[model samples]
Target chain A: MKSSIQRVKAIVFDTFGTVVDWRGSIIRDLSAWGECEGVKADWAALADKWRGRYEPEKDRVRTGEIAWTNLDELHAHALDQVLAELDLEALSVDHRRHINRVWHRLEGWPDAVEGLTRIKRRYVIGPLSNGNVALLVNMAKHAGLPWDNVFSCELFRHYKPHPETYLGVCRLMYLDPAEVMMCAAHNGDLAAARAAGLKTAFIPRPTEHGPGQKTDLEPTQDWDVVANDVIELAERVGA
Target chain B: MKSSIQRVKAIVFDTFGTVVDWRGSIIRDLSAWGECEGVKADWAALADKWRGRYEPEKDRVRTGEIAWTNLDELHAHALDQVLAELDLEALSVDHRRHINRVWHRLEGWPDAVEGLTRIKRRYVIGPLSNGNVALLVNMAKHAGLPWDNVFSCELFRHYKPHPETYLGVCRLMYLDPAEVMMCAAHNGDLAAARAAGLKTAFIPRPTEHGPGQKTDLEPTQDWDVVANDVIELAERVGA
Candidate 1:
C-alpha cells in the first residue's frame, strides 16, 4: 500500500460531476435568473435536458463529425437546442449568454474543496476535465477547488474517453501515466483512464444525477481505491 | 488611465527575472550545492553563463532548427555545456539533474507574492513564461505565487517573442488582446507582447543580471504602465 501510494504523485480529477454539483448548480443559476426575469419554466426539467445535451454534442467532436470546438461553444450550441425545445425563446440574446455562463460559476460538492485541499497537501491536484481552459479556470476560481494546475481537453483538442485527453496530462506534467491517478465518479471515465496506463480511484457521487440516479452509484470493477468521498480518497491514497 | 485599467481583465507575467529573482536564486542554489558537494568554482559566473544559454536554446526551437523540447530538457542540455566549460565534470548524472531542478525552486521577488495577491483580487493573474508547465507549477508551489492559471510556451510548442505565445493566453482566456496585460521585468518580453496587441506593464528588475546589470533598468518605450516593482504595478492597476 505504501508502494502504491508512492507510485501516484499527482491526481487529475474529472470536473463536472466528480468535483462540482453541476446539475444542482446549473438548476440554481437558471432558477435564479428566471425569478429575476419573471420567466417561468420547469427549471429542474430544463436543467436535466441541458445536461442531457452534453455528451452527444461532445460525441460529434469526438467522432470528427464537426470541427474542434471548445466547451463554451459546445455549451452555447446545446443551450440553443434546449431553449428551443423548452420554448424558452422569451430569453434575449444577452439572457441566453448569461445562462450559458452558468457553467463558469459551478459550486463544488460538499466534500470537494476540503477533500481537494487535503489531498493537495500531499500531491499535485488538478482538473483533467473535458471542459475548456476558460471554463475550468473560471470554475476553479468560482468554486475554490484549489487546483495546482488546469488540464482541459481544450488544451489537447480532444474530449474525455479519448486517449489524447487521458495521456495529455502526463505529457504536460512530465510524469509517467502511472504517476498520475485519475479520480472520477464515472466508471467509464475511470476505465478509459486505466486503459491509458493511469491509476484509477472511484468515488461514488450517488446523488450526482439526483435521487433517481441509476448508473455509476458504485464502483463496477476493482479500482485502485474506492471511497465514499474525496476525504476517504485522500486517506486511501495515504494523503 | 482608468479606461486602460478597466479594459485589462487579466495580467500575464514573465516568470524568470520578473516575479522571481532567478539570478539570485540560481547563484545561491549552485553555491550551496557546490559547498555541500566539495566542489569549487565561480558560481556567480557560472550562473550568468547558464542564463546566457537560455535564449539561444529557445531560438533553436523557434527557428525550427531543433524539435520542440521543453525548458527542463533545454536547461539540462545547457547545464552540460556549462559544466564542461567550468571543468565540473566530477558531478554525477544525478548531481547535474539536481542542479537543473534549481529553476523549480526559485524564490519570488520580495514583493511578488503580496503584490500578486493584491492584483488577483480583481484580475486573473498568471505566468506567461517560456518555462514549461511543470517548472512554472513547481515554482509557484515553492514560492507561493497566486496564479489563477499557468501559461507556458510549451503549451503552444513555440517560445516567446513568438506571436503565438503572447496571443495564446488571450485565446485561452477568451479575451481580446487589449483586455490582457503583459507584465514583465524584461523590456524585450514586454515589447513582444505589445507588438502582439497586448497591454504592457514594465517593472524594472535592475539587479536581475547581478550588480553589473546593464539593461532593462527602466522602460525603454512608451509602455502602458511603468512601475518600480510588482507592488507599484498593483497600485497602478488599481488593485
Candidate 2:
C-alpha cells in the first residue's frame, strides 16, 4: 500500500483480464459454439494465441507498418488467420463476426460487478483499455458493469503502454494524472501508468492467462495498492 | 415524424439551455450571489451575455482561430470579459472559478430526470454537449440525471453544429449516423445532425432563453420526432 490513495478521485481499470475473465469466458463460449457446430478444435489454445496476437498486430498499426484499424477489426483479422491455421474453413463470415464479438461478451469475475458497483457509489469507474469505446461500452452493458464513463486508447488513436492513452483519459476526466488511479492486473500496465504520473493499483488475476500462468503472479513494482481481487481492492480504497 | 423509429438506437442531447434551464438557473444563482456580495449588477443581462459568449468562443477554437481549449478555459476567458464589462473588478480568481461552475449546478426541468431515466432503460442516453466531460459528469451526478454515458464535443476536439461533433459521437459509440438521434431544443443543432445523416428529435424548451426569448419556440425543420418536453419525447419514442 502507498499513501497515493488519498489523492485518487477516479479509478480507470484495465478491462480484459483485470475486470473480466477474458480467457475463461472465450474458452467456454467457443468450446460450446464449436461443439454445437460439430467442430473439433482446441479453443483454449486459440484463445491464448488470439490474446498473443493483440500486441504485435497493434504495434504494426501504431508504428505505421500497417494502416490504422480498430481493435475489433484487428481481432477479426487475427481470428481469420487462426481459423485458417486451425483448418476451420467451414465457418461463415457471419459466424466469424459473431465469434469475434466474444471479446464483447466477457463475463466479470465473481466479485467484479459487486465491487465495481460499490466503488462507483464513491468514485468514477471506467475502462481505460486498448479495446475501442464501443467494445468497452457493449461489454459493460452485457456484463452489467456499471461505469460512470468509458475511456479507451482508441480515443487517443493509440494503445496501452503508450503514455497518450493514460494522459488522454486524465484530460477527458479533467483530472491531473496523480488524481487518477490506473488499476490493472498486469505490472506492465501499472508501470506505464506510474511512469505517466498516475497512481497504480495491482490486483493479480493469477488465472487471467489460465492455469499455469507464471507472469504477473505478484506485484512486480511498488504500486499504490495491491489486492487479491476487486472486492479486496474496493475494501482497501474505502469504496 | 419519421416512420422508422427503429433506426435511432441512441439519443445524444445538448445540455445547458437545450436540456437544463441555463438562463433561469444562472439568473437565480448570480442574483443570490450578488446579494451576498453586496454587488449591484444586472445579473440577468450578465447571464445572457455569458451564455452568448459560448458559441463564438468555441467557434474560434473549432476553426483554429484560437488554440484548442476546454470549456473550463473558454468559460474562464468569457468570465474575465464579462467581469470587466460589468465592472466587477473586485471579484477574486477563486470567486470567478466558483461562479463559472454555476453551469454545473443547474436544476433540471420538472420532467428531465424521470424522462431521461425512462429513456435510459431503452436507448443509450447521453449529452453530446460542448461542455467538457467532467462538467457533464458532475452535473449528472448533482442532478441525478440518468445518463448511460457522457459524449461531449470536447472528446472530438470540436464544438456542436460542427459535423465532427455529431459524426465523432456516432463513430465513438460504434453506431452508424442513422442509429443515433440528436435531441435538442435548438433547430441549428438538429440541422447539423440531420446534415450528418443522423436522426433528430425536437424538444421545445420555450423558456430556455427566459422572457423575450424568441428563437426555437417550435421546431423549425421537419425533424424525426417533435415533443413538448423530454417526457413527451420519451413517451413518443416508447421509452
The candidate that wins on TM-score is: 1
Model 1: fraction of native contacts: 0.55
DockQ of each: 0.73, 0.56
Candidate 2 per-residue C-alpha lDDT over A123-176 given as tens digits, one digit per residue, 9 for 90 to 100: 888899989877887788778888888887787888889899999888877789
TM-score of 2: 0.93
Candidate 1: where are CA atoms >4 Å away? none
DockQ of 2: 0.56
| TM-score of predicted structure 2, chain A | 0.96
Q: Which stretches of candidate 2 lie over 4 Å from their true place?
A: A1-3, A31-40, B28-42
What docking class should model 2 receive? medium
Q: Model 2, B106-204: lDDT tens per residue? A: 878888998898887778888999888888887876777777678887788888888999999888887899999999989999999999999999988
lDDT measured at residue B59 in model 1 versus the true structure, 0 to 100: 86
